[model samples]
Target chain A: MRVLITSGGTTERIDDVRGISNFATGSLGKITAEQFLQAGHEVFLLASETAILPEAAENLTIIHITTTDSLVKNMEKLVPEVDAVVHTMAVSDYQPVFMTALSNFSDDFSKDDLLHFSAEKVRKISSNSDFQLMLLKKTPKVISYIKKWNPQVQLFGFKLLAGVSEQELVDVAQKSLVKNQADFIIANDLENITKTQHEALLISFDRIVKMHTKLEIAQSILEKAQEAYHG
Target chain B: MRVLITSGGTTERIDDVRGISNFATGSLGKITAEQFLQAGHEVFLLASETAILPEAAENLTIIHITTTDSLVKNMEKLVPEVDAVVHTMAVSDYQPVFMTALSNFSDDFSKDDLLHFSAEKVRKISSNSDFQLMLLKKTPKVISYIKKWNPQVQLFGFKLLAGVSEQELVDVAQKSLVKNQADFIIANDLENITKTQHEALLISFDRIVKMHTKLEIAQSILEKAQEAYHG
Candidate 1:
């Protein structure tokens, strides 16, 4: 099977130099891609530039992406040719809301006057001793576009929740599966992620499968992909 | 000299699960700490947990910190004991303004009704399909507290400006030196940072010395510390 896997976290640029990003190591996706290749599958890995990966392999191809838009563009271009997708990338859901700079002078510049700029612009202003207000805008839902681009390709999504109970974790994962029309959703809590031993649940429409260790989860995901392809 | 150095970027929590952080790798700080140790100085490295570091040394002690508040707390405890401070950490200047969730929303909820909540509240709202506003509040300036905490320590601050000309970079660095009562300020442009080679200006009250590589900059900073300690 030809598979497309995205790993790591996407960054949203606040300026030419700085950006907002998450702490995803892309280890999960990298391991999963390696597992798929060891199982005799061709892999295209769309990974964040900062994500760490093992040494190169013959059956694997890697494309480094930095931002959410770039990830979308690559996915749109590559999804049609792949047989399945395992998207483990944490895409930013909000972009800095752009706002115009306000120019004025006075000890009493109203808070109302400062609300004109974005949190990003306010950060720039704060460096110069000027306190300003900032705003944010929501980014488009990237997962919802997958089926639009490739309806037949089997899709597996990842949902990470922090400080949530197991029931809440499963509930959210199930909602995500239905919303994205995904074949399976991998659910994990952040608290468990910090421990040496970790567990995750693979939620499909009819049942939930629990797996221990990231390597075991990756193997289970591959097995499900094979079933998806040959079923 | 007993030297204290800070490296990497601080993170500000946006919610229970997410945060705002910069792209600081702490490479510069790690290298500088190693250089200090090589110069026979006892070093205290206050670094972000995400920052990379070199192999362990007997003369070095590493304190891992995450947020600006944690950085401040560490500095307050260690500043008076150190002979010099090389603060290279990219401390976040803003934290996400958290908001309470609004309940009892209907399908016909008007946009005006949502405006009653804060921008932080709006960001939470936007996640569920009701687009709303976001606001940011400025974080306390961490550098400004250095002199207040320890008056006699020879302090070196770092200033990183993106897409700025040499004159602008120097001006900002010089201003930072005056504002913080810093002994010296190392200024660098972000555009030059991505290149194979990098350059920085050491701006003090009396003179500006330009250095060509990170290693050279680290060496120069150490020399300044030695001079301040002995002079």
Candidate 2:
């Protein structure tokens, strides 16, 4: 299977020293890539700059990209060839609305009175004809773009929720399946487990399966992939 | 304040090669210990056998011990002086109905000839009328045991669940709080966000707050500890 996975958070540079980054370690993305490779699937990872080292797998290809705009560019180039895509990266919802010339950029936040920057970097990236920017514009849903290119490719999307109950999670997951036009949705309780380690649950259409370890969860994903491929 | 925190899973030997262990990394407990120390509260950690190193903090007093019985012994010796206790360890719910000594044990597994071995190592350690191994016995809740010893000392307990919905979790948390007599409960959703770096929900008395980073969660826990101590 030709599988493409995205890991880590894309950095939307605010300045030379600082940028917007979602606090993510890319653990899930790395594990998914490892498992997919082990199962003899061709895997390509769209990774972001982070502390985690990508696992060295014989059949896996890693691409390091910094911004969501670049990620989308790479995805447009790769999505047509892949049979399945796992959208796991926590892409920043917005970048600075404008970009400064690299030569004139300042590392210190105090010296920001020079350039009168309009919020174009923020508005232009979010100004898709279909989506709107209310308080915060939604980053273009990568899955929708992928579907536009290759409608038959299997796509899995994730939903993380807090302060909501389990029934709501399943409801949200089901709703996301339709809203996002995804083949399957993994509804994660962002509040329960952390990257450290713990048991996990996989909620799918037929049933919910319990996985005790990270490896176990990855293996389950592999098995599900097999079912998807063979079915 | 002097605080005693127990964490990780206690492994009970099933035989020479196999055993039972709850999948706990002691991450939550260690983080709690780290939080306590950061808030100027003195902490003593009774950790289980895991390769991960305990984080160093100036206010922490690290104590390593194995087995539930040993942990109980340590608690008996130290609980008198501590200001609060957090029972976060995934202590074994059952010891081998009989513990076998290595010198007298034999490992021969033949499905046709099932043999049950009775050994002296399984003898009851303490004489308490309440400590009967009634068939299908539920593990004694640790917080209640600590409460019996020190009614004035604040105690927190942890509960882990898989595939439980959010509304169910709240009800379960409240019931556990009353049943365990815990001043507060750290209820974790084991199935969701198992390997993800960010995403977690903090369920308190009146609100379920969403936390997206380890640092934020750790800080929130520390703040809670400070509130508990100062109030």
Q: What is the C-alpha lDDT profile of model 2 across A1-231, one tens digit per residue? A: 988888886765532222444545678888888888877899989987552545677788889977778899999999899888888787654443433232222332211232232333321121112211111123555666878878877887766555467788788777777776777776665555566653445666667666665577667777777788888
**Top candidate (TM-score):** 1
Model 1 stretches with alpha carbons more than 4 Å out: A99-132, A162-175, B99-126, B130-132, B163-168
Which residue pairs show backbone clashes in model 2? A97-A121, A97-A122, A165-B166, A166-B165, A166-B166, A190-B199, A190-B200, A191-B200, A191-B201, A201-B191
Candidate with the greatest DockQ versus the true structure? 1
Q: What is candidate 2's CA lDDT for residue A199?
A: 46
DockQ of 2: 0.01
Q: Each model's TM-score? A: 0.83, 0.43
Question: Can you give the lDDT of residue A219 in candidate 2?
Answer: 76
Error of 2 at A228 (Å): 1.5
The sequence of per-residue lDDT tens digits that candidate 1 reaches over residues B69-172 is: 89999999999898999999998866655423223334333333333434432212225532323334567878888888899999999998766789998899
Tell me the deviation in Å of residue A45 in model 1: 2.7
